[model samples]
Target: MPKIIVEVMPKADLLDPQGKAVAGALGRLGHSAITDVRIGKRFELTVEGEVTEQILADVATLADEIFSNQVIEDVTSIRVEEAQA
Candidate 1:
């Protein structure tokens, strides 16, 4: 089996209220070093059987189409690797 990791995040140009609120809270809590905190989604998928290139490609497509919204979020990265036994 193999695991696929997909990361999706808001585009830089967009305003992230969640991130801003977190950053403000961190500053108030004396964690000023943490200036920016942009939140994102990470999806880990474990394939049932042997993983092939086609499977990886399909995963990427799913990441683009199903997992993320192109309007605000960007598919930052997608990775596929063997899963731990």
Candidate 2:
């Protein structure tokens, strides 16, 4: 099986409230070195067949359509890597 890794994150043009809140909390905790915090999600899925362009495309489409909200986030990247020897 092929493994798919999907990284989802908020568009750069959009404001991330969760990230902002985490940053604010960090500041309150005296973490001066930390300036910003961005929230994102990682999803790993196993495609039940050989890794191919069509499989990759379908996985990306499914992730965007169901796993994430396109309104608040964008699919940053999709990587298909071999599972382990």
Candidate 3:
């Protein structure tokens, strides 16, 4: 099986409230060096077939359509690799 990894993150121009809160908390906990933090999501999907260009294109479509929200979030990267045994 081939595994598809999708990473989604907020757009740079957008304000990330959760990330800001975490950064503030980290600073209060003495991790002041943590200047910025952006929270994101990762998705792992197994496709029961060979990894091909068509499959990758389809995965990209799925990432843009289903896994991520184009308004607030952007799909940063999508990788397809063989699953570990």
List clashing residue pairs in candidate 3.
none
Candidate 3 C-alpha lDDT tens digits along 1-85: 8798999999999999999999999999999889999999999988987888898999899999999999999999998868778
| lDDT of candidate 2 over 11-82, digit per residue (tens) | 888999999999999999999899988899999988787888888788878889977898988999889879
Candidate 1 vs 2: which has more TM-score: 1
TM-score of each: 0.91, 0.86, 0.93
lDDT of 1 by residue, 1-85 (tens): 7888899999989998999999999999999889898999999998888878898889889988999998999999988778767
Residue-pair clashes per prediction, in order, are 0, 0, 0
Candidate 2 wrong stretches, greater than 4 Å: none
Regions of model 3 farther than 4 Å from truth: none
Please tell me which model should have the higher lDDT, number 1 or number 3. 3
Error of 1 at 52 (Å): 1.1
Better of 1 and 2 by lDDT: 1
* TM-score of candidate 2 relative to the true fold: 0.86
Task: State candidate 1's TM-score.
Answer: 0.91
